[model samples]
Target: MNFDNNKLIKIIKFNLCFIITFIPSIMYLHLVEGGQTATELWDSFINLDFYSYYKMIFFLTASFFLLITFLKYVDLNGIKKTNYYLPAAVYSILAVLSSFRAEYKEIVIKGFPDRYENIFVLLGYLLLVVVAVNIVDNKKSFKLILKALFISAFILAIHGILQFYNYDLLATEFGRKLITPDGLDFFVDRLSFVGKKVIYSTMYNPNYVGSYTSMVGILALGLYSSSQKKNKLFISGILSTLLFSFLIGSRSRAGFMGFIAGTVIILYMQRQFLKKHWIRIFVIFTVFTLVFITMNARNLDEIFSDVLFPRTEQEKYLEGEILPPITEVSSEAGKLKLKTTEAEFEIIMASDQIEFLNKQPINVYNSKDEVKEIIFKGKQYLHHSFQINEKENYLIWNYGAKSAQFYYQDGQILMAGMHNNLYPLKKVESIGFKGYERLGSSRAYIWSRTLPLLKDTIFIGHGPDTYAMYFPQDDVIGKLKFFSNPEIIVDKPHNLYLQVAVNTGIISLLALLYLWGNYIFSSFVLYKNSDLSSWKNRLGIALMGAVTAYLVAGFFNDSVISVAPVFWIILGLGISLTILAKGN
Candidate 1:
């Protein structure tokens, strides 16, 4: 009996370490399907992609291990005693209650099943805290975990660098076929690098990669500073530099700002350590910054233009003169008519904007430039105007089936459609402090629409992940008009605070805040008391920095399956370290 128990514990520990090390690689190995319509029981249970499936397995394994650990050792003391556990418990309870009382029960139950999945996520994180606190009782296990993390970060960073140079290591034709044996083409299309130039790497989004690297990079910095061996320090420094470079290539503004904020906090906390190693740290920072800047100068320039001044390619076109009035207008069976200059012209518009009408003889020119004499089928015609509203100005291009229409005002392209030559107009910019209003990229608009819905469900929200169902009916967002599309459906509030408040109500949001605040505060307190010269204390300080970065980034982004696991694991590690520090 004793031998069996010892063997089981060894197996659990080995599995836990393996899961932690391989998470970064597994993030890219998703089995993409056509859509989210579940046809089987397994599909319904595990609707998300490969990452979620792997996490589910991790959760089950951890739960089983924890159950065995409890039965054999009778150690349920960790959960009962932890300072941050109660808030987490309350948050979980509230989340579960909210799911049951959800207005869109179908959405909560079927559509976006985050409500249930989130329970597992929360439990998994808590279990990690418990298991890590118990298992990693010594410096050796702690070092092993940190080393695994560094290795994962190194692999991800190298892959990202290769991807930036258009070398997709995992996305090759043969590779895709190997991963998806079903020969499903949807996975290829979904994961293929098409229009995007920035490398998403394993996380699938540039923002996610930015977030992941920001946290990992700061942790690497901690490890580098704490290492006693010259070779270990050098390797850690290289890993930190690689992660920082990856963060810059991601081009995520929120992530960049979060990383900067977190690093500053860490530096301030470890001022004593900085006093001794300031020169070396400064050199590393300078070298990495210069390298990143040189590689991404052009990308930065374009991003600055788009974010600050807000100009598009279509802005170059001139607003032409409004032509003569339309005498008559009619439409029948996918064709339109305009009667002017005592001539009736039949026009057919192309359904696809990108496909040019090559079958018909048409004279196309920049509307801003001179309007030439157009003769279609030996009928002379001049530029004609059509007004949807008295205040709105519209330019109509009539040349057989290749007709296009646009709304132009004050030398700017307001809205355009069915024109292969013209670009979509940029949104109307508001003159103000360019932080959230401008840099938020219309998230302000999404949030404004979402706030009004919270009045009815202030205590317990419409339920977890049910934001999509109700968001479409929002007065402002439902009829929200962009360049061509009049109706837009916003699935998320875009802000994590707003997402939590609207999904699970203000009380749940407060509970979540408390949970995070308590952990951060406790971690910082531990860092302040520990020996500044010790590597262990420096690591604790670094973990604090990582948590700070994740929280700041979370303000701009939501927690997803890809990056959330890492955040939780780091949080657990910090908690365990803090406890150990207190004991010492």
Candidate 2:
């Protein structure tokens, strides 16, 4: 056994990577109390904790790695020349710098509530990459990391399968208790949320599950392609099938997009291998087809109504018979008029308080104090508990759990906020997809808004994880029109490129692009030149495919902690394998 300090450091690093890759799938739950000045007492208690435990592990791992690397504990010999690391470092630097420019310094530094991709987490990802580049020195280490990834995938796949069958572990007493904090068992009934979707696995969202399986499924195929022994081939092949099934179960179009992109790349790179091994590929494809057809057989109506031909939220809101019919809405000369089937409303701006007039009853709920009951315009109303916040110039009405907000700007009642300087929404700009704002589940609407943000973020951005903070939260009209819910928090740009540009500056985004582009291009060079018979070369190509899938998926999905760490680890390994190819 090699007892040298460098060997020990490398061993420690690999173990850390392995842990980081696998542990996020473990269901660790807790509770987070809302901040001080929460409008509702119920708002203070947030349940279904999934991110914090992994975050603790990530923080500790990153800090430890940084400390050891600074102390020169790694095998300096394993470090090789690569164009990827510098841009990565630049991206990290720009992200940190952007934090200084952020309005919500606390959120920017620690990360936004719930989704914590703070500066420290970003650094953790970067350090993981650094660790991978420096310490993944041999085939044995690479294989071990791959094993860890597959194990994690297996766990997630099984859990997703269970959920799909309505055997959701989280619904069980043990499962409920696992995620719930002590003394919160009485609150479990309240925490037992209704209308929850099936098959989000451990990642919290089905879209994220899609993002995860998309990457792992490709890697599984890579393993299948490279495996020599019958047992190895069978195992990898089954894992691949399960991952694809899991991806299908997630029903994330983004995941499908990523998988397709990766598969195309694999076909192009391994065209010769496919031709020789056509039967193996054929059988796998047939099984994948069967899985898709069988799983979606009962939901064919949804395929037409939701997947193939879907209506936008705006279409649903206007065309559907749900809310009261709105007859007219007009704003002019510092006065707004809104007419509905039930009543007519007039809001006039003044130096002191805005004059509100209505033919029917209008209920006003102030956050400062609760109104028992009020009568306006001769109609009587009972106790109405709602939240209304007053800003310096604007009045914000935050409605429901989705936090749909309505505001008054320039004497006009608007759906979303257009006047708040803290989190401003850019003027509407359409860069293609013009009237098709409903495209990609209203992703077009999100992009329409996100692209305009880039004009200001060319050099410095809003900051890490501050995407939600800067997003026009008050854009209720767009939300209602596009999402059918005015309170929808479009926290992510939904497009990875836009996410980068909007959150961490255009330069940082470009740097990240360069890193990915360089790595993928280098992997291609290696794939074209290297012997496929070699395990390292095969694994290198596999890692390349995995990354390609994630990037394509990124077109529709933002990076989340659950999936990003795995991608970064694979990316780092691909870079390492590229180095090995060069050495060979």
Candidate 3:
């Protein structure tokens, strides 16, 4: 009995290591099918999206148990010299605070803060990164990750093929058919109820499929350029077929752009891989070209521009000019007949506006006539603010979707809604700066206003990841989706760097700075330390390329949240970059 107990403990400890290292690869596969491999693994586990709190709890519980089991036999002799405890410690702290960090108020009323769901998820990531780095310890673990990656790619390819054929295999508990996000079972009303859940597309959004393609493209480049020939050729075939699928999956402009930029990076990094196996390179290039030219599934496109078919008249209308980019819509009422200058129109503020007007109605009235009448008779507001203040609310011509009612906190004015192309454009359109005539980034506005808020709370950032709590205070403009309180769920920081800066603070910011800083140093090391045997450089360079692509894509797309699977892949790449601490 004693011997059996000891053996069971040993087995559990070993498997814990396996699970930690393999988790990222599993998560990688989630980007396809249902956007979570664990969800599929534990399909009966939850009632919400895979990235929701229920899934986070499951990961935390499983990880905590494994962690306790592993600590029983600490590999003290194995700790690397270069690995520091600062980053790890910071992550642990953030996770703890994230537990208390109420991103939304009802989340608190509903027990999210009390239970620390977000914190647990954040902590799980910290634990994964910290422990994976410590325990992986060698090239074999790296190979394991690669192998798992191949499996992930295989799963993705299989699903992409199935999605092409319009597959639907499962039925929901609610009697709805279980279909992939972009599967043929789509109904327009799905978005009406699903929130931001993967309702419309097979891979969540077109942007997601774009990132997946870019990631897979990078991974394939690494595999094709590896020292092994058979492995290279095998991945070559799989990746080539998937590349076509990725192109078709590319629905958003940013996704298509990410792929284009990611491909260039892969091309460059692979070009400089510096291996003597020129013959293998030829085979990779030949097979990829031949397969891509011949087969059609691998062509993933993010932008509508890349589609092979001729543009429909409806598409042309949506893409074409409708009206001059609106800067101010000061009552569409004023332009009943159309006038060059301002025209007289009955002025009545909407309910939301009426509430805002009551707060500082005195701020908008200038003359004795407006002021005396208001003060004497007890009224507020006037036609214009010539004598009052220009800083008062003018008008934002919001033609896009309205803000979510009972859900997430909407952040910056520029970074609020789902469709970002139709921004206030109050100033952006005036100079005719171009690029955003269609969809473009509103990050400039998001950052300019939010940075000062962070500067004030530079110490601990409201709490971990609490930008939404403080954003409305600084946002007096009443521009895009400014909620009255903190409970509204606005998840994005819009800018990934700013999100990190606010959630983690200056020290955490420096750790990130060092990580990127190391990328530069590591790139040089990989290039120089790399001669013919530097197979690791293939992945590092591809990752570096993908990171670049993510940054560029992030300017237009939201890649900061866990919902954005690209963020996880990029984090995994950071680990992969210096996996060999003292590189050759």
Clashes of each: 0, 7, 29
lDDT, candidate 1, at 506: 80
lDDT of 1 by residue, 289-402 (tens): 786776663455444543446532223112221122233343344344445433465544323211112223355443554343234443334333222221224445443222
> What is the lDDT of every predicted structure here?
0.60, 0.68, 0.42
lDDT of 3 at 528: 40
Sort by lDDT, top down from the best:
2, 1, 3
**Candidate 2 residue-wise lDDT, 154-245, digit = tens:** 87788787777677777788887886667776554543222354467777677888888989899998778766678988999999999988
C-alpha positional error of residue 298 in candidate 2 after TM-score superposition, expressed in Å: 8.8
Q: Using TM-score, give the best candidate's number.
A: 2
Candidate 3 Cα lDDT to native: 0.42
Of the pair 1 and 2, which is ahead by TM-score? 2
lDDT comparing candidate 2 with the true structure: 0.68
Span of 10 residues, lowest total lDDT, candidate 1: 475-484
Ranking by TM-score: 2, 1, 3
Per-residue lDDT of 296 in model 2: 67
